[model samples]
Target chain A: MGAGVTVDRLAELLVSHFGAPADRVAGGVTFEELEFDSLALVELAMVAQKEFGVEVDEQEFTPEQSVAGAARLIDSRRAAS
Target chain B: MPQAMPGFGVAVTGLGLVTPAGIGVDEVWRRVLSGEPTAAPDPALEGMPVDFSCRVPGFDPDRELGRRAAWRLDRSSQLAVVALREALRDSGLDPSTWDGARVGVVIGTALGGVQTYEAQQRELDSSGVGAVSPLLVPMSAPNMVAGYLAMECGASGPNLVTATACASGATAIGTARELLRGGRCDVVITGGVDAPITRTMIAGFTRMGALSRRTSDPRAASRPFDTARDGFVAGEGAAVLVLERNHDARVRGARVHGLISGYGASADAHHATTPDPSGAAAERAVRSALEDAGLSAHDVDHVNAHGTSTKLNDVTEARLVRGVFGDGVAVTSTKGVTGHALGAAGAIEAVCTLLALRDDVVPPTANLDSLDPEVEVDVVAKEPRPGRLRAAVSNSFGFGGQNAVLVVTRS
Candidate 1:
């Protein structure tokens, strides 16, 4: 909430940038469930950094993290900075 | 002459092209027949010694391929993917239902992902290592185009990339034919792609004096075999062909566009960038191809010469053709229209040869108002030539002394 990095926005980003199916991108959907490989996750992290202006360690962002979880992590990182 | 070479041919079922002339096979063929040059002022090559180049116009990769997929691939691979889609679609083969293991993919590229490599190197230099994408290796490697096509179509059989510099495309097709003749695969998605219009590649070619410096009139730059020809114009594009054994194609009821009756590949062991002045190795390749087809040179109605518009290549290739075909065969260099696509040139020309065979018309070489006096061949120029083009030879000679020739016959 601090950075306004909502789960909906994250989902939209995933769909747009990762070519994830629009219907498959949801708040509860995990990165693993979306078939985001390690490379894809790293790319997502870089994209997130560029779009959200937050420094999120790519390694810390695991495939098991859900869309909502990623939004929360981004919010926390934004707040910390 | 030998009656017919047993088991030395493969059926070309479908073709796709994204060249400077246009996208798709029909569009490019139309432009090539019209003898319109595709070279123009390239903003990317601005301030360089040879500033103009032939680029694939209206190629919005993000729109053609989904943004996500396009973002992950280099422009070279993107061109391959787009061309592969068209080829597969035209073949009436559905990858979703096909046996993936029975399919193969072979791609050829001289400078793979050079644009991507240059850009990523700049990023690393300016923003440090962390700014570089993890996809750099996958995007820049020469083998990745084959890998990408395999992934796209779920092809699991014998996938590899052939690099014979400018002859890479013909080499790929030749290799794919072997796979089929060897019973390794039922079908193969094979061809070449190169996006070499980047600043670094152009600068390198400029330094080598391998490119035409026709800054005043870019469109008239790629005049293969013309008396005024200097050097080749740099171009970027891709071409993919779906190949299968003739029997397999017939059994599956697939339309056979043409047959690759013979393929001959050789190396001069001569020089890195210069062809042998005598053109002996090139002649050997052509002779070998004709021998493999179990036919003599007289059977070849047309010669798709490797006329790169350069003084050396045009004269060498023209002499080779004259010695073999004796000025009786029709000769044309579609490179005049599409420019020199480097690795992709062979594949593009192969497709053009097939189209010419299919339509019984030889496309004219663009801007060849006056043939070079040293060139003693019947070079088709100005307008398309209509004839019984039952068979043709598509020649591709690359740097590093690589030579590959394919004898294509009408289906």
Candidate 2:
């Protein structure tokens, strides 16, 4: 994950991955609220890792978390690196 | 041999056909009875080893099925859905009044959505992964047709897809009949669909020497029982039948199209692609279907032969017919007119069988100029043969030595 990656960028990434309507892509919206299944989460993680070089462990993430929550975790991992 | 597992006596009330000959029951039957080969040069398949194929002419899925539904389904699934809609309408059943949960759907298909798979792969190559439609899995899965059919008819009782190569459709219908006899549902939508005219499949089948290469003469390519018969012409389409309890149909005063008195299936267990030339298992299938129907071989007046026009299938099926029904029974291969529709062959032939029983006419084997000396059976040719048909059997033998036979008696 890059330090420059922000909450809005993370939410936009998920919205694009899911083909969700742009208006529905709120940063605090949970994956479950966004109507994404486990497969969708796995795919989003795959694309995120491929693009930003950050690993998203499936066990560490939950559908309850919002896109901002995931973005913060990515920022923390990058800061540590 | 699986014994005749007849359940409560199932009756076919409606039939839907989307074939190379044409769409709808009457149109396809008329074309088939005309003894005109439906195979034509597929411009989309030009330059391929076997460019000509038997395509469902004038098929507009967007028009037949609405835009949303057509977008959500593969071509195979589209064909199934369209045929299913037609069959349900033909059956005169009020779906809104019926119990959707009690209905069942079983479809037979070999390559479910290979066409979709091919197109998506091309898209993935040209564009990025993001360009792929989210419904690809649902659209392309082999069982998706059954799933979509369930969605269409609200069939929740027992829905499944059988993939027994060429024998798939017949197997699905037989399996559905058994489920009905077992009291699984009040009605079942059963049939098969296939669209295998893609370049890769054509090339693969061509390499296996399974497709006819008589591109110059598309009309004469599928010459079943003829000495010049080389291979089967690849065809695409779907056929569906609405089957219900015979007693219930009678009580409702429904117009019974035909009675599925018997269903028999067996395996050669010999080879994967090549059938056993001895025709033992295939012979058993016919005998078992007859036994299951509670009818003797002499009762069957017409035989819808699976004469694929291939070197082995025609001769082997001819011998099987002779061995089972003796030499007097009328036999004709509808494949000679519609080409080989793969998984849907049996279901389409089943429709043809019912039509033959109703009209008392055996559709001719198209393009049979000279019957092979090796074939001793009476293969109908030239024009439709009008006869007194009390009972008929449709035989389907697939790549894995699978054999299935369905016996239908006059309604």
Candidate 3:
């Protein structure tokens, strides 16, 4: 966990991990809006674990959540650590 | 209305394989004959819920097929392409000369693109649907293996995929054999490919308690028909065989590996996952295969058992083997060495058994330290046994009570 992680970095990581476009994962874009299925979510979690050294439990997140919301949660966890 | 007898028999002209043992049919056969076990404790899976798995070693599809092509294909499809290419090469079937509509492709897979699906799930959870790749749906589909193979080899008669859990591979071959026998296709590339060794699949199996937990002794973990066996070790690989009508093969002057004498498929309809403990369904499947071959159980010289290494499967299969082949048949479960390749297990073992007939040897069942007392059949263990194998029967039983048996003999 680190404070240096930016929204841009998060978007890039999402694109790199999911093979999606960065603009499609913007602040207001929800998981469902982007058509992110369960399989895509798991890939995102694995990439997050590898890159950010954080484990994102599948039970904690939902399709209703926005990409910005997930980034904020990761940022807050980084701050707490 | 009476159906006319089948026109022609299916002959295996060439074979290909990509397994934990090695790549290509020759390499896989050599390793099987040497009694080698490919199960190993992977530290990458150390903290994971599933402790043991039979992973293909040093298989980098990108290195083999280039990055762009590898990216488009799942691990299972990659394995299938490699195997299919080898089989086509071995058969000397010039794709340029063959009639695409007269050739067929059938592939069986228990879990296809599971790894890709899992990866996509991670993306969906973190980002959203926009992150999902357009190729996700096609790549994750089980039939895509056959689709890819058909496209690669120009097989257009019947492109099909069978997904009967573990029996999928054998069922695929059986379907292809029927297609050939009915005079629907002259050549059919048929087999099984599975790469279900994903984190989620392992976790699910771990939760189900269907995987071995002996992480320290990987080689000794998968002891099929042995008293110490607990459960099967998950494996990933692919095996494909080129089947042609005997007349077509003769006309082409192709070297015939063996004849697919008969195939019998049955369903227990009793359970979704666990097999029928009575062994009636499995016995019927074996007997039907023998009958279809116009041979009795006595005609069978070697048996390639399903042998999942699970306690219940071992007992039920042993009873079925005894009921079919009696006490004297030389039987071996190659899953002891190859582990269970899920959908690909039966097809790969079928090919192995075919090779045993071709080479006149019984491939040994590795890691069987002590025979389960309840298993009345003769289980080949340790070193490969020399034998005059004329006709061999391979059994593949899967979840949802699906059972398939294939009888193959020397040409």
Candidate 4:
């Protein structure tokens, strides 16, 4: 599941889940720009868990953080495991 | 005991309600007093497993707010925004005159945007992410109501959303009171809104056996405190109240409808979905509210009960009411008409209680032909009960054993 989920797919999921425009949701966009509140972050984590089989902790995600950071973290975790 | 803070009383200056009973405060009161059950098998929910739901009548938020804005918001958020707009307008507080930093918004919701989430999920599953709407994420979060209200009203203070199930609304109002009492805000728009009558939500509640199966007779389905009651009917709505500090209201020459004198909240830490039959925690919540108001059981003349019409909730809430106000005080469950509004129940019931205090009339618990023998409270039924109501208590007990009680009195 980890190998199957790429940065582009994560970006797509972010765009879909956060309802942000796809162009604005690339690796550079912050969660705050997408209006991702705590509840949405929790739901996004659930979606990530269901789609990628990777349980993402909501607390670990920062609103100021970009999608690329999440992708890098997921990739690093997958490689380490 | 610690000395009571000076200028701590918070008065509800304006109220806005969007319920199955009706939209706006007066309309809701009118329908509630008429004892008309608004529960009906929604055609929108035809394919869903749960048959009966209490949907708001003629609710077109776009009529009040613009269509483009309504399109981006979920029903829950739309309800909150519209209700808050009415509440602010009723309060006569021009947002332009107030410091945005001193105004706050707190809204409570139970399931957030289950409908929007479900719709987006269907799209994601069927047509992939490209088919999902752009507003799906912002519209689905529970806190979006609070965020939207704050943005709409230009409130910059501590904006929050409480999700304590049914108690969420009362809790939101209680939080507003604290914020005003602490001098953090001069005015706070607080309440609860929920639009959870979605196919997935109805199916979930039905699967859990929490919804009434009396689809043929929706009006007779939600019989709170009645012996024939099976389970609660799902309802969608929101209620908002504008709360200001007593001194601030007086300074601004605002009409104070009623004072939110006290609020008490407690968690049973019991079952997630069932209440403690002993009703110990709920009793504590009621007692604590009374104590906070510097009153006794004798002072409360009316009670807005959290009678969900479920077998356990009705019995347990009745026992708690008896324990707090004794069998003498008049008790009524608005859910009999509103059909268990989940998270918005407390706030909507609180508004009803405030109106009852204002009008000196208690709305009846509709459809209660025969009272449950296990519940001994004086359940007001059939018609509105006229009385000299000075102080009224509204109880909201949610799932997760969360209990909140609010005491409102004539200003």
Worst 10 residues of 4 chain B by lDDT: B1-10
Per-residue CA lDDT of model 4 for B1-411, tens digit only, reads: 123542245889988888899888889999999889989879888866567789889988667666436667898888878888788889998887789998889888999988889889998999666446656878898888888898887899889999999899999988888888777887899999899988877888888788888877889999999999989999989999999887778888999989999888999988989898888988898888888887888989999999899889999888888877788799999999898888899999999999999999999999999999999889999999998998999999998999999999888
Runs with alpha carbons beyond 4 Å of true place in candidate 1: A1-12, A21-26, B1-7
Better of 2 and 4 by lDDT: 2
Best by DockQ: 1
lDDT of 1 by residue, B225-291 (tens): 9999889999999999999888888999999999998988889889988899999999999998888
Per-residue lDDT, model 1, residue B33, is 99
Per-residue lDDT of candidate 3, residues B66-87 (tens digit): 6435767889999999999899
Better of 1 and 2 by lDDT: 1
Tell me how far candidate 1 lies from the true structure as C-alpha RMSD in angstroms.
2.3
* DockQ of each candidate, alpha-carbon based: 0.60, 0.05, 0.04, 0.03
Local accuracy of candidate 2 as per-residue lDDT tens digits, B1-411 = 123344235889988999999988889999999999999999879899788999999998867875435656789988888899889989999887899877999889988998988887887898667545556687788989999888887777888999889989999998988877877888999999999889988999999999888988888999999999999999999999999888889999989998888988999999988999999999999888988888899888999998999999999888888888889799999999999999999899989999999999999999999999999999999989998999999999999999999998988
Q: What is the lDDT of residue B248 in candidate 2?
A: 84
Ranking by DockQ: 1, 2, 3, 4
Which candidate ranks first by lDDT, i.e. highest?
1
lDDT of each: 0.91, 0.86, 0.84, 0.85
Model 4, residue pairs in steric clash:
none
List TM-score per model, in order: 0.96, 0.84, 0.83, 0.83
- Tell me the alpha-carbon RMSD of every candidate: 2.3, 6.1, 7.8, 8.5
